[model samples]
Target chain A: MASIELKDIVKIYKDRKRGTELLSIDNVSFSVDSNEFLCLLGPSGCGKSTLLNMIAGFESATSGTVSVGGKPVLGPGADRGMVFQQATLMPWLPVWENIAFSLKLAGKGAEERRAAAQPFIDMVKLTGFENHYPAELSGGMAQRVGIARALLLNFSVILMDEPFAALDAQTKLEMQEELVAIWQRHQGTVVFVTHSVDEALVLGSQIAVMTHRPGRIRELIKLDLPRPRDSTSAEFNEYKRHILALIREESALARADAATV
Target chain B: MNWLASLREQRDRLWVPVLLIVAWEIFSRSGWLPPSLLPAPSTVCRTWADWVFSIDESSQANAGRWIHDALASSVRVFVGYAIAVVSGVLLGVAIGWWRWVEKTIEPTIQMLRPVPPVSWIPLAIIWFGIANKPAIFLVFLGAFFPVLMNAIHGVKTVDRNLIRAAAMMGGREAQILRYVVLPAALPSIFAGLRIAIGSAWMLTVTAEMVAVKSGLGYVLWDSYYFLRYDLVIAAMISIGLLGFLTDWLIKLLMSRILHWQHGQTVQGRNH
Candidate 1:
């Protein structure tokens, strides 16, 4: 069964300066099966994050519906955990406390919350740094905290919006591997949004290529690659070349369309 | 040796005040200005000691009444400031959090804000009848706006993403406000508190001089009527010292609560 579903979604944003309504996402629809890792691949200005946000119930579609766990998403709820592009941790809270924020909100006592946060903290590999604030953490460590915070809530679906986009190349690669390992062990549906072709190819079991503006799903490519998918592998490169071509074609079309206008 | 090292460390903060006092004392003795009109720091100190200790009774009626007057002003400052802090923070959070609160309450608040708190002395007198109530009211009026404005700004500027994250974690609105919004807005609120405190002391003095019978401002005004400039200067110094002391106390509290901000902000970078 699908763990998450979007039906005939359309999003329109108001350009207050121009006093005009701009179409952001038009007639986007897709579903992710339980435990399926779905990567949304697109260029900047495409509503990839917007689409993920709609699933997380941070944003609502101008029309159509977003459903998770067989219920329509009215607003943001614990049922759909999200890791933002930026860590967005409560700077005032220490690592353990930030990880246990949901429990704190649920009225759990400090001891109980701390106890619960321990496993997730260890899972995210943030062991000794649990007392540290978000400001003290490096970009990669902070992102790990964000992931742990989401995972602690035990949401069946986790949505990520270019979570490692700000990290250096080395850190990003390590985090990507760690994320895949965690996903394999925990087995949850993930909707990861990214503008990177390589990131999409490296992580996604199913890659949904999106168009530039008024974002529509151009194609959904399924990957049957083996565990620990190598970026240098021939199959991975083939998938990368194909997705790159699709993105290149979309960008060319966007440029041509702009020229005419 | 330790005291010497500490004094050396404090040299940057100490030099200006020391220089000003020494120059003022020399100028007062040099007769550049009448000693009575601009009493020397030494004269003020002597008068202040007499007022506090009743040494030679030079401060006359105010001698040995210093503690009583200082306590009265301190109480008024504390009560009025406490009320302002509570009401301002609550109203501010409400104004910042809800559009309805902002739309309905903020306009009237903004309208009242620009009207000087000192101008309320007549109305304060008429309403509360030359008592502590009028002085307290004035203090509230003076301190309330800064706390309210800062609270609103702080709440409004709390990272939107943090709220979104909390909401996603199934946090109720009230819980989010308490756990997320309040802590995030604290630095701004404290900033407001500091400014409001300064205003609090100013209003207290202004009120004491006109509406209330006791306090440092009353002593200042009464001494001026008696033509006792030394006692008047002493009263001024007392008020200034009290204001500085209270502000320093707040800074200490701010440091304790917002220790998380240390090394995270530009102000905290030196340490």
Candidate 2:
């Protein structure tokens, strides 16, 4: 059975002043098996993040159902954890406190919260920086805290909305490696949304390349590469070239549609 | 040498205020206006010292009574400001987090906020007659609005993602407010507290002037009636000193609570 399912999900945003309805997600259906790292790849404004939000239960699909672990997602719950693009951390809280915030909600004591947060801190390689405030940390460090905070939930699935998109290229490469290593160890499902072709090639178990504007899945390509994917490898470049051509064709068609409008 | 370098760097800060005092003393002694009319800074200091220390009772009725009067005024500000802080924060969180609370109560509060706290004097007098009660009630009114407004702004402006994060972590609605919303809104709440403290002092003094019989403002008004300009100047200096000290205390507390805000804000440089 699929660990998470999005069946015929449609999202329509109403623009009140314009008196118009804009459909964002167009009857998109997909599922992720247990422990699968499915990268939902698409262009900007293609409602990819909107799709992840639905699975995380931050948004409701207008016309379809989202279910995780055989239960319909009525709202956000601890069963699913999410790491946002911008490292949305509490500025007042130190790294350890931010990581253990959910524990605090669970009415855990200081000792317990500290204990619960330690393993995740080590998992994200932010061990020494536990007491540092978000403002004091580098961008990559803050995002590590974000990752640690999400992992501390100990959920079945984690939703990542381009969590590494803002990192410097070198830092991004390192974090991707660390993320894969963590996933290999802990073994949980992840739905990572990204626009970067290389990021999709490196991270995803299966790549769901999406069409633009009222997005639908164009292809679901299961990756069969070895661990620690070498971007310069011939097969890796072949997949990149193929995805690039598909994207080029998609963008051209989008432009043609815009010209008609 | 390290200490000396630090003092040298801040030398102008010391000298400028000293210079102003010296110039004022010289002008006051120049006999342009009578000593009663414009007492020298030294003369005011001497009278203030007599009032505080009762050195031969130079300030007469208020001799060694400065502490008592100051404490009385401070108590009113403390009680009233505490009440305002609790009510303002609670109502603010409610209004910011819940539409029903905002729809029901916020319009009334917004309307009342614009009506100056001083204008409530007549009703304050009638409702809570001549004593600490009226003064405190006025202070409450004065301190309430800034706290209320800031708390509302703080709650409303909390990052939506933080709430979303909290919700995803199995946090209930109340848990979101307690764990997520409160912490996120705190810097702004502290901003409100600072502004409210100033209002607390102002309203306390104003209340003393009109209704209360004891405190610095009463002493100032009382001395004015007797044409004791020296004592008046001493009282003004006392108020100014106390206000500065209170503000400094709040700043110290703010730095402690908002230590994470350092190197991120423009005001971070001063600390």
Candidate 1 chain B worst ten-residue window by lDDT: B262-271
> What CAPRI grade goes to candidate 2?
high
Q: Whole-model lDDT, candidate 2?
A: 0.91
Candidates in order: C-alpha RMSD to true structure: 1.7, 1.8
For candidate 2, lDDT tens digit of each residue in A79-116?
Answer: 88899999989888899999998888888999999998
Candidate 2 A-chain TM-score: 0.97
Residues B69-163, candidate 2: write the lDDT tens digits: 99999899889998999999999999998999999999999889889999999999999999999999988998898888889999999999888
lDDT of 1 at B41: 90
**Compared with the true structure, what per-residue lDDT tens digits does model 1 show for residues A1-261?**
239999999999999999999999999999999999999999888999999999988889999999998899999988878999999999999999999999998889999999999999999899999899988999999999999999998647899999999999999999999999999998999999999988988899999999989899999999989989988899999998898889889999999989997
Residues B43-133, candidate 1: write the lDDT tens digits: 8898899999999888888889999999999999999999999999999999999999999999999999999999998999999998789
Which residue pairs show collisions in model 1? none
For DockQ, the strongest prediction is: 1
Off by more than 4 A, model 1: A14-21, B31-34
Model 1, B116: alpha-carbon shift in Å?
0.7
